[model samples]
Target: MTLPAPLTGVVPPVCTPLTPEGEVDVPSLLGLVDHLVTGGVDALFVLGSSSEAAHLTDSQRRLVVRTVVAHVAGRLPVLAGAIDMTTPRVLDHVAYVVEAGADAVVVTAPFYTRTHPAEIARHYRLVAGRSPVPVIAYDIPVSVHTKLSAELVLELAADGTLAGLKDSSGDLAGFRAVVTGARARAGITGFSALTGSELVVDSALALGADGAVPGLANVDPEGYVRLDRLCRAGDWDAARAEQERLCALYGMTGVGDRARMGASSSGLGAFKAALYLRGVIACPATAQPQVPLSEGEVERVGKHLAAAGLL
Candidate 1:
C-alpha cells in the first residue's frame, strides 16, 4: 500500500524473531506480524532498532522486508529500516527493501565515521533523490552519536529531502520545534512528525506530532492505538491515565540482569519473552551475541504482563 501523507497513529517498531541457531524464524515472525495487525497498529515498521536491523545479515534484512510485505498484502504500509553507517551503504539497503516492496525507508545520520551537518544534509538529499519511495529521517542520537539539530531538520523538510522524522533523540524541546516548524513551513504539506518516544506518546500528540513509533507498542498495540485516539479526541485526562499505565508496564525492560547484558538484550529480550508467554510467538529467542533472559527475568516479564492484564 502507498503510505499516507503525514502518516498518523501507532506504528510499532517490530521485533525480529530468531531461531535457536540465530536464523530468522519466518513462522514466528509472521505470527508476530499478525498479532500487531490484529492489535490495531496503523502500520508495521520492520528491520528497525527493535528488529535488530544492525545485527541482521544483509540476506536476513532482505528476507524480513520481503516476508512482511508479502504477508501483509498491502493491508497497511510497511516501513523498512535502511540503517547503515553511511549514505552509500544505506542506499544499497534502500534499493533492496524498495525492490522487496517496502512502502518507505527509515534512515539515521551517518555513523562509525564522524560527520558534519553539511555532510548529513548532502547524505539525505542524495538518498531522497534516488529513492522510489518517501525517506523518513531517523534522529537516533543515542545510536548514531550525532543529534540532528532542529534547524537542520527544518531545512531538509523545507526542501523536501525528508518526508518525515522519527525523533528518538529524547529531546522534546527539539521535537516540539520540528512539530511547530512542520506546521508553519509553507507548502510542506503531509510532512509526518512521528515520535520514537514510547514513554511520551500522549505528550507528543498533544504538542502536534503526527504519530508515534513506540517499541513498547509491539507488546500492547491496542494501548498505543487507544492512546493515539484519546489524544486525537482531545481527551487529555484519559490519555494521560492510559499512557501512564503503559509506561508502568514498560518497566519490564529492567527485568533482564544488568551485569550480564546490555540495554538491547534487556529490552528486546523482555519483549520477546512477554510475547512468548502471551502465546504470540513460539519462542522468545533474540539474535545471537545478545544474552537471553534468565528464568528469573522471564518470570519478571510475566508479572509485568499480568499487571498489564496481558497474561
Candidate 2:
C-alpha cells in the first residue's frame, strides 16, 4: 500500500523478539505483529532502535523486513529503518527493504564521524535520490550524535528530500518548529511530523504533530491507540489521563539496575520483559553486550504492568 501522505496516529517501533540464543523468533515476532494489528496501530516500524537494529546482522535485518512486510500484507504501512553509519550502507539497506515491500524507509544522520549540516543534507538527498519509496528523516541525536536542525529539516522538506520526520530528540520546541513549518510552508504538503516521545503524545498532538511513534505502545498498543483517539477527538482531559497512565507504565524502563547496565539495556530490556510478562513475546532476552534484566527486574516490570492493568 502507498504510505499516507501525512502518516498519522500511533506507529509503534516494534521490539525484535529473540530466542535464548539471540536468533529472531519468527513465531513470537508474528504474534507480536498480530497483537499490534489487533490493538489498532496505524503502522509498524521494524529494524529501528527499539528493534535492536544495531545488534542484528545483515541477514537478520532482511528477515525482519521480509517477515513483517509479508505478514502485514498491505494492511498497514511498514516503515523499515535503513540505519547505518553512512550514506552508501544506508542505501544498500534502503534497496533491500523497498524490495521487501516496505512502504517507506526511516534513516538517521551519519554517525561515528563528525558531520556538517551540509553533509547531512547531502546524505538525505543521496538516499532519496536512490530510494523507490518515501524517505523519512529520523532526528535522533541521542543515537546519531547530531541533532538535525529545524532549518535543515525544513530545507529538505521544501526540496522534496524528506517525506516526513521522526523527532526523537526530546526537544519539543524543535519538533513544534517542524510541525508549524510544514503547515505554514508552501509546496510542502503531506509532510508528516511525528514525535518519538511516549510521555508527551498528547502535548505533541496538541502542538499539531501528525502522530506518534511510542516504543511503549508495543506492550500496550490498545492504550496508545486509545490515547491517540482521545487526543484527536479533542478530549484533552481524557487524553491527559490516558497519557499519564502510559507514562506510569513507562516507569518499567527504570527497573533494571543502572550500575549494571546502560540505558539501552534497561530501556529495551524493560520493554522486552513487559512483553514477556504480558505474553506478547516468548523471551525477554536482549541483544548481546546489553545486559538482560535480572529476575527481580522482570518482576518489577510485572508490577508496572499490573499497576497499568495490563497484567
Candidate 3:
C-alpha cells in the first residue's frame, strides 16, 4: 500500500505516564497527550525510546497504544514504535498495532543478536510485507549497536516496502548517503528521513529530511516548532540557537545515562517529574523501579527550566 505524504512537522517520542504505585498512569498519559497537543507538535509517537517501550510488557504496550490512539481522537497521526530485535515478534506486534489503528510503525534493525546486512534487509522486507500499514525504518545504533546500512535502506526504498526511515545514528555521512540515494531512486516518493537527535534538526532538514522525532520535544515541543520554522524559513543561525537551547534541557536530564535512570528507562520519569513540578502533568509518579529524581536533581532541573524560560 502507498504511504501517506512524507510526514512533515515535529513528532515527539512521547513518554509513558505511570501511577505513584508504578501502574500505567492512564489519566496522566491522557494529560500528557493534551499537553503535547497544546504544545503544537504535529504528531505523537507512543512506545518509542523516549516512551520506554523496552521496559513495558506486551499488554502495557498495547494499552498505551490503544489509549493514545483513542485520546488523540484523530487530531494527529499516532505512530507506534514496534522496536523488537526479532522479526516474528516484531511482525506480530506490528499486526496488533495496525489492528489497533496506528497510523504507522517504526521498526528498528534487529539488535539483541548480531545479524548480517543481507539478513537485516530481509528482516525489514518481511516486516513491511506483513505490516498492514506503512513501515518506518528506525536506525538508532547507539541503543541497539546495530547499523542498518544506507545501501540496504536504499534497496527497501526502491521496493516500496519501507515507507520512511529515522536516522538516530548521528552519522552525517550515512544520513547524506541515504538521502541522496533515495532521492535518486524510483518508487521512493513516500520515503522520508527524520533525525532522532534534536541537535541535528536543522542540519537534517538541510539534507532534505522530513522532520525530527526528538526526545527533547517531550519538554520543549514549542522549541522544536520554532527550530523547524527557523530552518524552513532559511534562518540557520536562529535554528542552531534553538537547537542548542533544547540540548540544554537535555543536559539537565543527564545526557545518555540520565535518560536510562532507575526503572524509568528513558528519562520519562524525570521528564514527567519536571512537568509535574511545572504543573504541566498532574501526576509526577513513574512506573515501579523508576526512581524519581533526588531533591537536588529536581532543584537543579527547576533552575535550568527557569533559566530557559520553560518554567
The TM-scores of all predictions, comma-separated, are 0.99, 0.99, 0.92
Per-residue alpha-carbon lDDT of model 1 for 196-296, expressed as tens digits? Answer: 99899999999999999999888999999999999999999999999999999999999988898999999999999988998888889998789999998
Task: Report the C-alpha lDDT of model 3 over 47-134, residue by residue, as the tens digit.
Answer: 8888878878899999999999998878899899888979999988998888888999999888888888888888988998888788
Order of quality (lDDT): 2, 1, 3
Model 2 stretches with alpha carbons more than 4 Å out: none
- lDDT by residue (1-311, candidate 2, tens digit) is 99999999999999999999999999999999999999999999999999999999999999999999999999999999999999999999999999999999999999999999999999999999999999999999999999999989999999999999999999999999999999999889899999999999999999999999999999999999999999999999999999999999999999988898999999999999999988988999999999999998999999999999998
- Candidate 3, residue 175: CA error in Å? 1.2
Ranking by TM-score: 2, 1, 3
Which candidate gets the maximum TM-score versus the true structure? 2
Residue clash pairs of candidate 3? 263-289, 263-290
CA error at residue 112 for candidate 3, angstroms: 2.1
lDDT of 1: 0.93
lDDT of each: 0.93, 0.96, 0.81
Kindly report which residue stretches of model 1 are placed more than 4 angstroms away from their true locations once superposed: none
Residue 48 CA displacement from its true place in model 2, Å: 0.6
